[model samples]
Target: MSIGAVLAQLRGDFPDVTISKIRFLEAEGLVQPGRTPSGYRQFAAADVERLRFVLAAQRDHYLPLKVIKEQLDAADSGAGPTAALPRPPRRLVPIDAPAENVGLPVADDFTVGKELRLTREELLEQAGIDAPALAELQQYGLVRPGPAGFFDPDAVLVARTVKAMTEFGIEPRHLRAFRAAADREVGLLEQIVTPVYRHRDPEAKSRADEVVRELAALSVTLHTLLVKAGIRGVAGC
Candidate 1:
């Protein structure tokens, strides 16, 4: 089943289910659809059933994805598909713990929640930026959120940096190059890790994560040294 077929099958009930939303849920580890050599998503009937469970959990039970994902994970491991699952409380969304991604480790201590959760209003206030400014940052691909509608801590840092740059008259448009460069770096990294991630081995996933962290650290170091060298050229010292 192609992604389009899955969308068509689900969208009658889940009208807001866009392709990106499905991809976001995949990123959250909700469903594992196979991908083609050309990177097209291929959903199976089981994937559709899982997607339905997620939608029903959110819409009928009013459960946050975190809680729903836990139940799903339990079921996937041994609880028997959709059997003997605990009923979720019909309540507002709670503060979420950090999610373990394919390679991400446990959350580190940060002033903001270690999971990097922030509502839009909270991010604006903390970053000392306005809504429009934040919107511009997102528009320029400098920041983004998951489908769960929470910004990561990096988004707040980006907002703060952009705000400070505004003092020097640097605007979001001028930051497009930064976004482009970051995208290129990510593309290269993805090529290196995609095969490891596709493997179903726990150790492979761990190795992939280590590769990600080391490469990311190296990239940052290179960026910092280049910036320093550029500044020295202006200082002439």
Candidate 2:
């Protein structure tokens, strides 16, 4: 079956499942669907079953992707899909606390490329925000559609994060600072990269891409550390 057909089959059970979520799971190697010659996904019966198991484990058991993958591996190894799986304890962190085990930023984390093309409704659904909230985000210039009038995948992430922040009393209007900061960072990065990116050498584009990725990672790291330091000062930690 095509990916859309697989999505349709899963939607009755997993209403929150979007194409991006399925693509993310595939990227994580949970379901190894075959690809056609034109690079389209083709889900076999086994693939759909694997997705069912993964989604069920996540919804019913709150299993993380790592644990879910281990279970899938065990099943693939003839242990049966019904084999017992381990469950990790979930912990709640304070809102002001930095996340645990964030680790060091990596270039790949900031690599700006994706194939997602979501409609406005898909973005709202995936982001868990209502139409009014989306309009607010647009008003603040925090979220935007691409030239093709479809949202980039990152917009979903941005909208989701903004929604979560709203729980802390942060409004979309207040997020303008964030958008401005990001714009400034992008402008700075562009100034630094455009020269190398426009070089006459054959390898210029590749080298420029690598440089931008590394710089982007470093910029985020710097911003995170600064925020942590400021928070510590504010909280007298």
Candidate 3:
């Protein structure tokens, strides 16, 4: 079967599947189709099945390609079945619904855990972004590495989110307002915490930290609600 035949076979199940997406999966080494002497892709039945597995894992399970690849590799090695893949632990909740413990904010919620550091290649793979996309994100200040030249988990999240946003025709330059808004919000939060943070008493400093965490949570909630309201108005909901 040619690549086009493979696409036709999967398109009924995955309406959004495209030749480009299939090519990308091949580039990521998730699928290995044979190439003819003319350099045209020659997909086998197993290759089509593998593409289905990858697409279904992404759509139904929200598994990253890296994890999906690992599962595929494990399956190929006869280690385990891909059906044993893990699902996200948390319940899927509606956007309008308040999450559990919305009022209680913990320090862990505000801090990156374990001081994780990833190289550029790792960040790209985890974030599912290419170098040019990453560069554009950095150009817009939407994603940045630390002074030590390593990216944190937050950078990965930002790059991934921006990549998804691009599907709706949103570009990096269009996200500048988001960066500006975040900076302004952080500045305002700082103003409220600076005095408490400066107290000579250690207890005051601790209290300031707690306050910042709580306020950070509230700020995010407020922003989400405001955006929801505005979107509803726009949608006449």
TM of each candidate vs. truth: 0.51, 0.57, 0.55
lDDT of each: 0.73, 0.78, 0.78
- What TM-score does prediction 2 earn? 0.57
TM-score of 3: 0.55
RMSD to the native, candidate 3? 15.8
CA displacement after TM-score superposition, residue 189 of candidate 2 (Å):
0.7
Winner of 1 and 3 under TM-score: 3
Clashing pairs in 1: none
Model 2 weakest 10-residue run by lDDT: 86-95
Candidate 1's TM-score reads 0.51
Evaluated at residue 103, the lDDT of candidate 3 is 44
Best of the two (2, 3) by TM-score: 2
lDDT of 3 by residue, 1-237 (tens): 998999888755664467988999999999999999999999998888889888776655545677788889989999968454333233223334454424433232674348789999999999998999999999999988899899988898899898899999999999999999999888998999999878897656655665676567667667776887899899999
Q: Residue 125 lDDT in model 3?
A: 98
